[model samples]
Target: MSQAKKIMNDPENLVDETLDGLVAISNGLLAREPGSRVVRSTKIEQGKVGLLVGGGSGHEPMYGAFVGPGLANASVSGDIFAAPAPQHVQEAIEAADAGAGVLIVYGNYAGDVMNFDMGAETAEEDSDIESKTVLVRDDVATDDYEGRRGIGGAFYVVKAAGAACAKGMSLEEAAEVTERVQYNTRTIGVAVRAGILPDTGKRTFELGDDEMEIGLGMHGEVGVERSKMMTADEVAKKMVDMVADDLPYESGDRVAVYINNLGATTQMELLIVYRKVAELLAERGLKVERTDIGAHFTSQDMAGFSLTLLKLTDEIAELIDAPCESVPFTQG
Candidate 1:
């Protein structure tokens, strides 16, 4: 088989090199922990609850890019599609610790749960810094709610917790807000094609020209169903219907919509999807308080997108509107 073509000094150095580049270009906004894959903010507000997040390397601007003011104070990264080591997670926990406490936000993947949990235990045992966690499980395709995998809806969870911290909320308060965000969100994704694995230089999954997979995972995990391709509007209605009905979002309720690109899909295509989403919501008399469309989370080179909706209460809406500064996301 032909080796995969990647622009890099060495595949082994990809993660480290990427971290170095990110910090250098951050304009003093970020710093790297010595000899570790953890990256943290250079400025942490005193006496506020610190927010920490982490995951593998392939999903750029995700667990890492979202670290900054009004967001995560630090983030830990592992190898592509691999969970960070417990020690790496611990470093982030330590970096995010303010006098108040720290809150760890991450996906519901098994490895992430185990490592972050271990890191929290280690921090308490060593330094007595109180830490808590909120696991994001927004994918609606899975029947096992507790075991549902986290995906695009993670953005809402981070935003809620970060804002709570920014408001000087206690650790318990921040954690409660984050949990509320997690429960009030739902996401569903479809893939027209699979992504290529950098290590192997091959597609993670195979799809025919006329086929699409619904509820596909970020890491190429099996989806719930496969069928012939549908029009952009048809796909939009199908996904939005599933997500909306699951939450039983009422006609008078407002929501925040996030349309995320998986990897290789064009912005024009994503916009087309969003247009249909907007129209469908209007038809249902559901108000769109906010809408975000772009490639926030991705499966490396995967050709598809996911839709996330956050059912909004006054508190959640206010928190979502709060200011945030991060590498990939910033708002007033």
Candidate 2:
């Protein structure tokens, strides 16, 4: 097979250049930290909790794009699919500090955990900037909830945390809100085709033309099962069943449904999936308080989608509905 196509100046300069482009188009909302890969919001308010989220680069409009009002105050990015260096994370922690302390949020990956933890320690020791962390572990495919890998459900975590911080909640209160959101969220994804790693320019994994991998990780990690491609309705049923069952959602329970495009999946397909999800939820007498559909979290051109369900309480629902603005997620 022929190699995948990527457009860029140089593979080495990809992340930096992308940041430059994002800042340029941000209308002064985003600024890059000198000598580091960290991006910060230009409008962070003093005495409000600062939110910092970082991770590998390939997931566009995620860690970085999420830096704005009612979301992360800053974001640190590593090379594609790689964790940022500890020093980089520390720099973000320091920059995000605004006298109210900073909260570091990211996927529950081992490398991210280690690096961010070190960054928090550095900030506390050197800058006296108190830092806390909220690790998102919402993927239900894993048996270990505490150690479960974070997925698209990170959106809810960031949303709730950002809203709390914007409302002038204390750093501790914001962190608690974030943890609450994480606990109530769950996500599962299926991959119809694998994505190509930017540096290597090769597919992360191979999938048959007529097959799909269910419960696949964003980085193409092995999932629970791989089988023939099912109809959209069938796939939606399976995905919703797995996610809803895990949460043990019952009749009359309210939720926020997020249908995320893995990468190459089109909006049309996502809507089709959402339709099925909505139908299934309705069948179960579950109420969808809000719905977000788009490529909020992606795997770099991978053709698939993920279903994220946030079982909502009154407070959680209010947070998700709070006004926010970012490149990918925006609410009035």
RMSD of each: 1.3, 1.0
**Alpha carbon lDDT of each predicted model:** 0.89, 0.89
Per-model TM-score versus the true fold: 0.97, 0.98
lDDT of 1 by residue, 23-55 (tens): 888889999955678899887898999999889
Candidate 2 lDDT at 69 equals 90
* Residue pairs whose backbone atoms clash in candidate 2: none
Q: Write the per-residue lDDT of candidate 2 for residues 1-332, one digit (tens) a residue.
A: 88678988789988998899888888898899555699999889888999999899998878778988988899999999888999999999887888899988999999999999988898899999998899988888887788789889988888898898888988888889889899999999998999998778989889999999998887899999899989999999999989999978899999999988889998888888888899999999999989888787789989998899999999998888889877667788
TM-score of 1: 0.97
lDDT of 2: 0.89
